[model samples]
Target: MTPSHPPISGASSRRLGFLLAAGAAVLFSAKAILAKFQFRYGLDALDVMALRMGLALPLFALLAVRESRRAAAPLQARDRALILVLGVLGYYLSSLLDFWGLQYVPVSLERLILFLNPTFVLLLGVVLFKRRVARREWVALAVSYAGVALVFVESLRLEGDHLALGGALVLGAALAYALYLALSGELIHRVGPLRLVAYAMLVSTAVTAIHYVIARDPAGLLRLSAPVYGLALVNAVLCTFAPVTMTMAAVARIGSGAAAQLSALGPVSLLFLRGWLLGESVSALQVLGTAVVLCGVLLLARPAANSVPLDPIDDPLPGQAGNPPGR
Candidate 1:
């Protein structure tokens, strides 16, 4: 049921954005699982990113080539410069940092730290747009933040130095990711989601490849035959392509800050999915933690900024961002 809160200036748009963001989270959750699969098969973290991006590059390019036709004029010099920076920061550099940090930190703690992205996004909105969050949004934010803190404290208590480092790296990932969404939100208005993601992924993949060319061992990449390749493909398709596309689409609908708030679901989904897939038993605390985070999602979904005047549900336009791509 829709909450009592009055919707924002654009209720329908915000609702549209929220669903797409959650859809993105479902796909984005696979990142950890696929990375774990690669590690299990003996591929180093860098090698895994390298192989995954190598495959991802062409697919991104194919879309980009098609989307570029939408532009009325050649990309301005400033946009090209921004694209370069965004490509390096959003995907290659930040992702590599996450990989390195994961080596040092505990898994759950890293997720908790990464959850700070919403906070970052909020802070950026305040600073950049003078956008003030409403009371309900604040409450939802608190619940989400509190949930993350509890999980992190519990996770760290059971950890090592590597896990600790992972926590720091994940924090950086959150910051970079926040920057990506905030900036990309503005840029999407200019470039459109499809072209932006396509170009960004293509450039980011090329940038990642340069690192692999310098130090990667070809034998290491080839060691794991079919399973590893399949996992890498899964990582690229689900983790990178699918979610990022939704995120961009969400940005197009609602502002990126709202979308970022919903992004708190990623780690929560990861915990459950990881536990279920690996057959790892979840303790009471973890389940409680997941519930706490979910409460935050339901609260945020209450339609704080926009007013929903329609029926129980609003039918979205075709090719909507939240649905599976091309649906």
Candidate 2:
């Protein structure tokens, strides 16, 4: 029998890609942690979400229009309708929920919830599409979630009920986003990713605007201070636009599921960033838990026989901070 040889270079490339994805995590992890800074400035959550999305829209639109002119993919009316539904659910609604939830949750805790994309994707794929999850993949999913538990414990200590509730909202958002990942590839093939993001943002803006009208959010929009404005800039450009675009690029390279799976490590990374940035001084027990959780994430990344093609539609990252529509 011949001994199997490993693809050393391929492994190296995947590591590089994972590191890039981790870079995405670092940028994304910063959003909510910084948003916590807004309390000093008295910024409302809705107003922040609105501003964040508003700033990002123009930039995304410019690229989307150029892409439309270059490699446009046409879809039938039904397809258009489904895509719209997806955009509203995945990008618009999810963003609203996350920003609102952020007020009640620590950034670290919310990251754990948001990173549940892999679990949501796996369960959704298995139950809805009858897809098979590799045994090792299952272990990875469990480990990724263990990381969530670690973060949640610390988050709970930091923010109490607010953190738990915020984590729950982000979990719901992650589930919706997971569904978006599962189906977005087929949709992207019908329409390019740029256009998909543009349309999704537009649709999300419309939806969020209506919700604001109904709920009467953005009461504090005009009173935003300098620090608040700065956070809004980070939310819109750095967290919303930059990482979203880069993650979409990653989706184009790897598949959305794999990308999302790797993203499960985001909360752990955020834990350290927040600790370093905010002097969070996480407990020794939490550090141990974080390590254990990370080990689970590595298990998920272990080689599988087949890797799925990616079509990740990262409309609204399940992150913290955004300005309400028209805020």
Candidate 3:
């Protein structure tokens, strides 16, 4: 008779997932700070974005090559097209808006606005995917928006001139990324999360390069300061690439819902980082708003009533035999 193996405990998997997600969130939260730092050197959003993607391109290309070699089948033309479109939408457009918005807004406010991504995802699910939102989720959405409103008011009081423009741009970025997440489910399952991220980012790199060529002279890229280059490298490796892979791994281990819940750590960490690095003040109202936002997101992250639990065997890494589900 064959030997029996014990099933992995849900609690343990979730714990690991939370750790990974939190790490990714903290790293991702650093992007705004780094971008803001770069801005102090008088670089435009397009220039900063181009440098980031330029540095990251080779790494993602290597990942794509590695993943392609291990892929069970070659990518179809349709798959390539989909990956290109999603990449443009998710990384290129979303990041441009985000970086541009950062020029006008403080890092803390930028993070808080971007943190609304989960709510945007929920809304997209209901409208586009026809997924039903429970009444509890409705309450969560209300609470989350209320928190955002509080922060927005505070931001307006502090930086009223650019607050509206900055908030709108950042909100646009959030919506763009939310749409990417919503539409990527099927493709992520088909391609595997890591492989998908690798290929899509490669496409985004190309798009960003083209944009850079059109928007600025090639000599401009070489003129950036050494510290800016260092920060870009850090952003590329530590923030962008690391978080993308880590978050996917976390999702594979635990589910997307669980991973997303842990992402609530992002805004809080950003607040502290901004205070320490950018000399941004953290007000009492901001703290209260942060708490409300986190609570709302946690409520939204609860597993759906009809959702099935993920088995350990089902949570395979990319290129594994059990690579059927998306992160």
lDDT by residue for model 1 over 130-158, one digit each (tens)?
66566666776788778766766666665
Q: Name the regions of candidate 3 deviating beyond 4 angstroms.
A: 1-18, 252-255, 305-327
lDDT of 1: 0.63
RMSD of each: 7.2, 6.5, 6.0
Candidate 1's TM-score reads: 0.75
The candidate scoring highest on TM-score is 3
Q: Write the per-residue lDDT of candidate 2 for residues 132-183, one digit (tens) a residue.
A: 6666667767776776687678657765666667777877777777666666
115-184 in candidate 3: lDDT tens per residue? 7766787677667756665677788789988998898898788776898898889889888877777677
**Candidate 3 lowest-lDDT run of ten:** 318-327
Q: What are the runs in model 1 whose C-alpha is more than 4 Å off?
A: 1-23, 104-112, 127-141, 244-265, 296-327
